[model samples]
Structures are given as C-alpha cells and as structure tokens.
Target: MPSLLAVCAVHALRPDSGSVGVTAIDKRPLDGEVRVGPLGVRADVQASRKHHGGPDKAVYAYAQQDAEYWERELGRELAPGWFGENLRVEGIDVNAARIGEVWRIGEKVLLEVTMPRTPCATFARWVGGAAARGWVKRFSEEGRLGAYLRVRRAGEVRAGDAVEIVSSPLDAPTVLEVYRS
Candidate 1:
C-alpha cells in the first residue's frame, strides 16, 4: 500500500528581474489535513497559470524513490516538498502511473493522474546558479519528473493517509513516458 509522506503548499512571489513573478517554489509540509478542491489544494498558488494549475493540473505528486535518487546524485538529503510537489508519496512507482489513473487518498479525496510536470524557467531560477541547467537536463533525460493530477473528488488530505489505486487505464502512456516524450 502506498502512503502519503507529506502535503505541501507555497505562496506566489515576484522574481528580481523578470516581468513575470515566480511562485517561490518553496513548499512546506502542513501540520494537519488540508482541503483539496476543484482548483487544487486550498491556499496553494501557482504563479504561472498558463503552464500550471488548472483542471488538468490541479495537484503535483512526487515519489520518494525519485527524491532518494536525486539525493544520491546531488549528495544532499531532500525532504518532502523539496521539488515543489503537493504530495510526497512513498512505495509507489509514480513513473509508471498512467494518465487517467485514479487514486483515492484518505477517505474521500480522489485524484486522477493527468500529465508530467514540464521543466520551466521558474524552476531553473528557483534552483539557481550554474547547477540549474545540469539539473534540468538530467531531470529531463531521466524522465522521473513526477505526475500532475486533477482533483476528482474534493475532500481533506494529510500525511500518513493511504493511497489506493482506484483505476489505471490500459494503453495510456505512463507519466515517465510522457515526460520523456
């Protein structure tokens, strides 16, 4: 059984030079249950709505396994939400999750895997420095970019909740495949 390791949310902010401000992709774990609504996790903000946060991209979930891989590669420990994921999931192969796959969290919140998060300038800037390019290239090539999900049923969610796979459509491209392509 997969489990929710953490739930995170962040505030939107303006970048130093760019006309478009960046949502400081810094997400911190919530202490208790948080509401999941049609748009997304309540109070969560996405600076770039053209590329993120919509009915098809309401929530973002990253697998702990992928984070562990980055930790090994970067030679640093990464906590949940380090990659700006709304939910840090453990014991699940997020790369293999298919588009349209449905997952139930806790009792009522339901989410459907929709797509893979595309790397953006905001992400690069958030990472900062010369290492950003390398990180982007490697992440793109590796295809472990994590899955974007749409809210199927609005409810409360929190860490330690069980993640139940309600449906996984056949013939749908996996999240990793979508990322790689």
Candidate 2:
C-alpha cells in the first residue's frame, strides 16, 4: 500500500543559501504528529513568498523512488526531505498522479494534487558544485519532479501513515504531463 515515509519541516532559514539569498529548502525529518495548515506545515517556512508557499502550493510530496534514482546518479545518499518536500512517499509514483487527484493521508489531512515542482535557480544553488552544473536543465529533462498539493483538510500527520489516493478528475493531466508541457 502507498504510505508516508517521512514527514519534514524546515529546520531553519539559511539567509545566504538560495538564489534569492535566502531559503528554507533544507528540511529535516520531524518526530510525531506535524500539523498541516492551509499554507503549509506548521513548523515550515518559505523564504521567498514570490515563488513558494501559497494555497495552491502548500505542501510538496516527493517519491522515495525518485530520490533513490538521484542517490545513484549523484553517488551519495539523499535522506528523506532532501528535496525540500514536506512528505516523502513510497509505493506510488507522485509524478504519475493526476492533477486534481485527492489524497486522504491517514484518517485526516486531505491534499489535492496541484502541479509538478519546477526546478529553479534556488534548487541549483542549493545543490552546488558538479551536481549544480546544468542542474535546472538536467532536472527538467529527467522529469522526476515531484507533486505540489493544496491542503483541502488540515490535520496532524506523521510518518508511517497510509496515503490513500481517494479521487481524481476524469481525463485530468498527470504531474508528469504538466511538467513536460
């Protein structure tokens, strides 16, 4: 069954770490129940509101499988939340989830699939060095980008919770489809 692997929140804002000269992208796994609000995780913060943190992009979820692929390519480990995702999931392809898909996480917290995460200069800067070279272009080409979600129902969430894909609109575009376009 599809399940949550990790629940994370921003550890702190690094004032000198991103394209905008600040970022909350370096997340850390959180223990116990983490509150999910309309804007995002209770303990999380986005440094650049112009590019992140809104009703339509409240929570980011990435596939553990996708992270594994990166680990192999980068020759290093990618711990959960490494991609700045609030949730790291397994047993489901986040990129394949249809837009407008509704997911029931645990017994609470409903999240509607919104869009694919777009790689940006902030991401490239966060990566740095050899991996950062042509990163935006390479990431765009790979199409392993994760899904952004809108919080439909807020609740406390924890790792090990089941993720049920409850519904989706008919003929809705997949995350990958949106990313490729």
Instruction: Give the Cα lDDT of each candidate.
Output: 0.86, 0.91
TM-score for candidate 1, please give it.
Answer: 0.93
Best by TM-score: 2
Write the residue-wise lDDT of candidate 2 on 75-131 in tens digits.
999998889999999999999999999999989999999999998988887777899
Q: Candidate 2: misplaced stretches above 4 Å?
A: 17-19
Clashes of each: 0, 0
| Candidate 1: Cα lDDT at 157 | 93
Query: For candidate 1, lDDT tens digit of each residue in 98-128?
Result: 9999999999999999999887666766667
Clashing pairs in 2: none
TM-score per candidate, chains pooled: 0.93, 0.97
Best by lDDT, which number?
2
